[model samples]
Target: MSLLHTLAMHRAQLPLNALRAFEAAARHLNFTRAAIELCVSQGAVSHQVAQLERRLGTRLFHRLPRGLALTDDGQALVPVLADMFDRVGAVLDQYADGRFRAVLNIGVVGTFATGWLLHRLDGFARACPHIDLRVSTNNNRVDIAAEALDFAIRFGDGAWHGTFAEPLFEASLTPLCAPSIAARLSSPRDLAQESLLRSYRPDEWRRWFEASGSPQPVLRGPVFDSSALMVAAAANGLGVALAPAAMFTRELIAERLVQPFDIAVDAGRYWLTRLLSRKESDAMRSFRHWLLREAEAETPLCSE
Candidate 1:
C-alpha cells in the first residue's frame, strides 16, 4: 500500500486516546511522566501506547534501561501529530461567543503600512476582535492570487486588469525636503541644482515639475523601491523627494521633513484591491467598511 493510504488506515484504526498516550509518552520519553500528565496509571498509559503500536504494526518506542526513546517511526509521527493537534486547538479557539475569528490576510505597501495603517491597527483590533488580521508589507507590487492574499492596499490609478479596485485616498505628490534644504532660494525652478531622490517610477519628478509649471531637470540620484525609506533619506538632507505630503504628516509635523511647494500632482491614489473572482468574506467586508470609514474621516476622499 502507498504510504499515504497506510497512514490513513492507521488513523482510522487508532483511537485518539491511544494517539494522545503515545504523543505524551514520546514527548517526555517516560511512561510514568506521561501517566502523571494524563492523570492515569502508568500501566494504563503503557497499555494505550501498546495498543497504538499494535494498531500501526510497528514498535514506536524503545524500552531503554533508564526510561524510553522513540524509534524512527515515532520520531516521524511526533511532528505530524503535534501539528494536527495545534491546528485543532487553533480552530477551537475561533469558536468563542459562537463566532469564528476569521483570518484576513492582507498585503499593504510599506508607505501606507507604516505611515497610516500601523497607527490605526489598535483601533481595528478593538473594533473587529473576531477578525484575525495578518498584514504583510510590499512596495506597491503584489500578486493577490499568487500570494494568497485576501486584500491589497497599493498606490496606483486603480486600473489593474483583474482586480476590484476601491480608492482609499488621493495621494498627491509634492516636493519634500529637510528644513536646511528648504532654506534655499524659493521657486520651483530652483530644484534644478538639488539632489533629486528618485523612486523606481521615472515620471514622478517630471510630473511634479509639469504641475508646478517648471522645466524638468536632468535627473541623477539614487532610486528607492520604498517611499518610507525615500522619505527618510529626504528627511536626513540627502535629496529632494517628490512624495505624498499627507502620508508623511508625522515627519512634517516633527519638522524632520519639509514640503517646499503647494503644487501637487495626481500620480495616483491609494487603493484597496482584491481579485475580481474572489468573493468577499465577512472579514473582508468588515475590513473594507472600516477602511472606507477611516479614509472618509481623514477627508471625504474615498472614491466610489
Candidate 2:
C-alpha cells in the first residue's frame, strides 16, 4: 500500500460517534452514563465502542463491573480528541450570530485574575453580554500563540515578541497578614522574626524590605506557587506575605487581612496582550473597550 493511502486509511478508520462515545465513557467510566451523555442506549454505546476497538486492533478500555478504565492507548488519544471536539464546537458556536462572534480565549496570570478581575467581572459581563469570554489562569508563564489564546493578562514589562502589549494597571507589593499577625508586628524589624510566606517570585520580599528601609530578612520560608495562595496563608496567620494592595483591598477592608506597613514595592504592570497575527473580532474589540474602561474607573492604590 502507498504511504499516503495508508495514512488516509488510518485517519478515516475511527468513526466520530465511536470517538465521542469513548470520550464520554472515559470521563464518566460508566457505559450507562456515557449513553446519557451521547443520548443513546447503553447497548448501542457498547456496540459502537466495540467496533472502534476492532478497527484499531487494540482494546481501548479495561471493562470493570462498576465501570471502565482507559488503556494506555486510550489515555494518549483522549486529550487530542477532546481538544479537536472543543475547537470544532467553538467554531460551530461562532456561526450562531450570523457572523462569528470571535472567541477571545484568555489565559490570565493568577494573582490579578483573582485579586482584581474576579471582583470586576460582572461589569464586563453586563457590558458585552453576547461576547463569549473564556478564561484560564496560570502563574506568569503563558504563550499566546501555543495555547490558541487571543489575549493574556500577564504581569511584566509587556515586551513579548510578535505581540502588542497595552498597560492595564500597575501593581505594588506590601506586607499583608491577618490582623492577628499584624497585632504581633511591633515594628518592621519584628517582621524579620516571623514566618514570611513567599511567592514563586523570589525578589518580592526583598524589594518590600528595602522599600520599608529595613534590612532584608533572610529569604527562607514556605514558598507558594502563586501570590493568591501565599496571601491566603498569611490571612490564616500562618505568616506575613507581600502582595499588591489593590488586589487584596477587599480582604483588607473586610479585616480578613491587614497591611502592617505602608511600605510598597513596584513589581510590574498588568497588561492586555494580543498576538499581532490575530485579527480583532467585534467581540474582542468590545471586550477590550469594556476592560480598559473598568481599569480607568478603579484608581490604583499606588502610582509610579
Candidate 3:
C-alpha cells in the first residue's frame, strides 16, 4: 500500500482514546498509573490498549505479573506519540491571548540561578513576552541532550567535550565566613584554626591559601556538592566556606556572610554552553544575544 493510503486508512480506523492510552501506558509501563493520569479506570485503559493492539495487528506489550513491557512495535511508536503530544500541547499553549508563544527550555547551575539569573529574569520576560521560558537548575552538571535542554549554564574551564561554550564571566574563589568568624580572624593564617567547609573541588582551598601567601592547611571538614549549600553552611556558622564571591552577593549584602580576607583565586568561570551538533533555534539566538548583552552590562571592562 502507498504511504498516504496507509495513513488515511489508519486515520479512519484508529481511535484517539486507544492511542492516548497506549502512549501513557508505554511511558509508565504500568496500566494503573496510566489510568490515574488519564482519569480512567485500569480496566478502561487495558481495554483501550487491547483495541489498539487489535487494530494494529501486532502485540504492543508483553504482560507481566507486576507491570508491562514494550515490544518492538510499542518501542517504535512511543517516540512518535510523545512528539505528537508535545507538539499538540505547544500549539494549544500558544493560543493564549491570540499570540503564539515560543517555548525555550534552559538548564542552569543552582548558584547562577539563585545569585544572578533569577534576579534578572523579570526583565527578560518583559522584553520577550512572546518567548515562554522554562528553567531547570542543577549543580553545575547537566546532560543537555538527555534532559531535552536547549542551553545549559555551567561553571567550568569551558572545555566540556562536544559542547560549544561561551564565557559569561569569571568567578573567583575566596574565603567567606560568618561575621563572628571574621571578627576572630586577623590574617589569612587564622583560617587554619577554624573549620574549613569544602566543596567537591579539593584544590580550591590550596589555591586560595597560596594566593593569600599562606601555606595550605590540612582540610578535614564536611564536603558539600554545591557552592550554594557550602555558603549557606558558612552563613549559619557551621564553618568557613571557600566559594565564588561574585555569586554570593545577596548574602554578602545582607551581612549573612563576609569575605574575611581581600585575597581571591581564579578557580574557573561560568559559561553558556550548548551541544555543538545542535542547530541554534530562533529562541536560542534571542536568549544568547540577551544573555551576552546583560553580562557585558554587569561586568566592567578591563583597561588594555
Candidate 4:
C-alpha cells in the first residue's frame, strides 16, 4: 500500500471496542470481572480481546487455570490507556450545562482557614452562585505553581517568592485550656505542673511566658501541626494549648474553652497570596472584596 493509503487503512481499522475490552480485562485479569464492569457478556469480552490481539499482532494475556496474567505489551498499554481516559473525563468535567462554571481553587493554611473562613463559606457561596469554590487546607507548606491554586490564605510575614502577598489579619497567641485545666492555673509557676501542647513553630510558648512576666516553665508536650487541632486537644483536657484566642472566639464564648492568663504573644499576621502570573477571575475579585469587608468589620477598634 502507498503511505497515504496505509495510514488511512490503519485509521479505519482501529477497533475502539476491542481496545477498551482488552484494557479493562487486562487491568482486572479476569474476563468475568471485566464483562461485569463493561456491562457485556464474558464471551463478548473474550471475543473483543481476541480481536485486539489479532489487530496488534501480539498476545496480551497468558491464560492460567486460576485466572489471567497480562503480557508485557498489555502491561505497558494499561497506563497509557488509563491516562487517555482520565484526560477525556477531566475535559468533560470542566464544562457543565451550556455554560462553564468558573472554578476558584484556594489553598488555605490549616488554622484560621478552618476556624473562620470554612464557617463563613455559605455566605460567599450565596454571593456567587455560579462560582465553584474548591478549598484545600495545608500546614504552611503550599505550592501555588504545582497545585495551580488561584489564591491561598497563608499564615506568615506575607513574603513569598513570585507572589503578591496581602496582609489579612494579625494573630495573637495565648494559653488556652479547658475550664478544668484553667482551675489549676492560678499562677505562672503553676503552668510547669501541667502538660503544655505546642505547635511546630518554636519560641511561641517562651515568648508568651516572657510577655506575661513569668519565668519559662518546663515545657513538655505534644507538638501539633495546626493550632485548631492543638486547641481541640486542649479542650479535651489532653494538655494546655497556647493558641490565638481571636481564632477560637466562638469556642470561648460557648464556654467550651478558656484562656488561663491575660498574656497573648504576637504571631505573624495572616496573608492572602497568589502567584504573579495568575490572573484574577471575576469570582476571585468578588471573594477578595467580601473578605476585606469582613476582616475590617471583625477588626477590633482598639487594634485599629
Clashing pairs in 3: none
Ranking of predictions according to lDDT: 1, 3, 2, 4
How far off is residue 195 in model 3, in Å? 0.9
Poorly placed runs, candidate 1 (over 4 Å): 15-86, 93-100, 300-304
TM-score of each: 0.75, 0.75, 0.82, 0.81
Badly placed stretches (over 4 Å) of model 4 are: 1-19, 50-59, 95-99, 145-148, 276-290, 300-304
Candidate 2 error regions (>4 Å): 1-85, 94-102, 302-304
TM-score of 4: 0.81
Clash totals for all candidate models? 0, 0, 0, 0
lDDT of 4 by residue, 1-304 (tens): 3333332456568587887897789778999999999999999999999987776666779988977999877777677668877777655665766566677889988876767787889988888777778999988889999998989888878889999988777878888899999998898778998999998897888987888788988889999888888889999999899887877878899989998888777878888899989888888898788887777777521100
For TM-score, the strongest prediction is 3
Model 2: worst 10 consecutive residues (lDDT sum): 1-10
Which sections of candidate 3 miss by over 4 Å? 1-13, 24-51, 58-83, 300-304
Model 1 clashing-pair count = 0
TM-score of 3: 0.82
| Residue 284 of model 4, lDDT score | 85
Q: What is the lDDT of residue 74 in candidate 1?
A: 86
Measured with C-alpha atoms, the lDDT of residue 33 in candidate 2 is 96
On residues 1-304, what C-alpha lDDT tens digit does candidate 2 reach at each position?
Answer: 4333432477777688988888888888889999998899999899988987787767879999878998877777678778889989989997787865556689888878887788778877777767778899988788888998878888888899998899888877888899988998878899988999888777777777777788987866799888888889999988998877778778989999999888788877888999989988777788788889888987575311
lDDT scores for all predictions?
A: 0.87, 0.82, 0.86, 0.81
